[model samples]
Target: MVAEADVSGKEAAALIFTYGTLKRNFSNHPLLQDLILNGDASFIGTYRTVQNYPLVCGPYRVPFLLNIPGSGQSVHGELYSVSTDGLSRMDELEGTSRGHYERLPIKVVPSGEEMEAKITCAEAYYAHGSYAMEMWKKNGKQGLKCYTENETIGYVKRKDRPQHLTFLDHIRLFLSD
Candidate 1:
């Protein structure tokens, strides 16, 4: 369910999971730049879809995520908190009105942390209905297979090593101080 506004007239922040161009430093990053900077956000988790989905290259070589499942690979992505207005702008850019994509809730778990709190539910833009089918047809099953299997494409593989310094690193620095 979409997050509802609070009694105080402020909308609850919506958590959105992104695995493609919407990611930081990507082509579409600017669309969410302000929201990400102004809101409470973090790289909360990484997860592969329980089912396989198509990640095909569209016109201009931009990748699109199709709704197909059971392809047997884990997809990785990040989650961010957004205001209702930010979500609406994202919907417009994603062509939600034209049915290019649909926002659907999904489950994800943190890659390295063993804590139960790391598992979360957030909304994501999945290629919807005929949009997915048409993209798959245009790209062909073989093409989709190759892209999903051989290429990282839209996935962000979790690194075994943490991207940020750990407590140990900070402690060591403190000792040297």
Candidate 2:
């Protein structure tokens, strides 16, 4: 079961649990750095998700958390406290309206030695469809291999692929076809 944190005044900043691109030094980090109160935030819980989902690299070569049941491996990521505006910006970037992802509240545990006693309820951007997995499979096994080998880097730019496909567009097409 998920534990609930005291989210009263002065501690109500929305918590965000990120397991992919939004992590430090990744491509999307710049968008969140200013909004993150703790750059050194702790991991939410164990690296596994409640339901299996593929964590694959999309056509953009960026790592995407696919919401495919029974298809993911144990994954690691960070947690941050973001203001309301920050959440909006993050939603925009994740294409929440366009169905690239869905922002949902999740239960998280503080991994910091000093804060281990607290459990946080946070929101996370989870991949909403199978496009990411399809794109990853189409790219061959190389992308998956690289991601597994190096968990520190969340996004990878593929010089060979054109930037014509936006992440949202890819998902839309996949769902329609």
Candidate 3:
């Protein structure tokens, strides 16, 4: 007798967790502009914000979160559910794989109600010595707090200054790999 084959359905939309610049008023945030001018994507409501920066996972050779909140107090952010093709566009927008940052799997929401989402992780490829180390290091154990206690959403104050690492530097490191 012949047996039937099992099939799986396609994934429904890609979810992204934004923390630093991707939120509302980060210095580099241009998503809203993209929506108005570029028309690249839209927002969803299925992600959680944690007080942590991206760290490299030795096993996957990728970056992942070191700390995240499990309850109370909402960390400010927006959940973007984009089309499959839009992920490529988002990658370009986020500079993923090009060394500025990368994408990785992360859980969203403190309640664990929704499924996991993709987050922009800082690349270890930037670890080109002490200079790069300095730029990529995270001081706060519970993810560096980018906002003060009284700061409102979309207006959080960054505890540190933004770096101006050029595309040339990123290209050099990534190409060397």
Cα error, residue 114 of model 3, in Å, equals: 12
> What's the CA error at residue 155 for candidate 2, in Å?
5.4
lDDT of 1 at 112: 49
> What are the per-residue Cα lDDT tens digits for candidate 1 across 1-177?
445433124454667777777776675677667655655233444553433566665543445666666542445666666677677788887768866678887666554444454457777787766555656666655334223323444444223334595423422332344
lDDT of 1 at 61: 45
lDDT ranking from best to worst? 1, 2, 3
Candidate 1 worst ten-residue window by lDDT: 142-151
Maximum-lDDT candidate: 1
lDDT of each: 0.58, 0.55, 0.39
Tens digits of per-residue lDDT, candidate 2, 88-143, equal: 77788887898778877665454433334455566767666545556545545332
**For all the candidates, what are their Cα RMSDs to the real structure?**
15.3, 6.2, 10.9
Off by over 4 Å in 3: 1-12, 36-40, 46-75, 110-142, 145-177
Model 3, 1-177: lDDT tens digits are 001211123232355655544556544356544642443345544344433333322111222233322422344355554444445666665555655455655444532443253443211111223233333333222233333223333332232322464544633453344
* TM-scores, all models, native as reference: 0.64, 0.61, 0.45
Please tell me which predicted candidate would have the highest TM-score against the true structure.
1
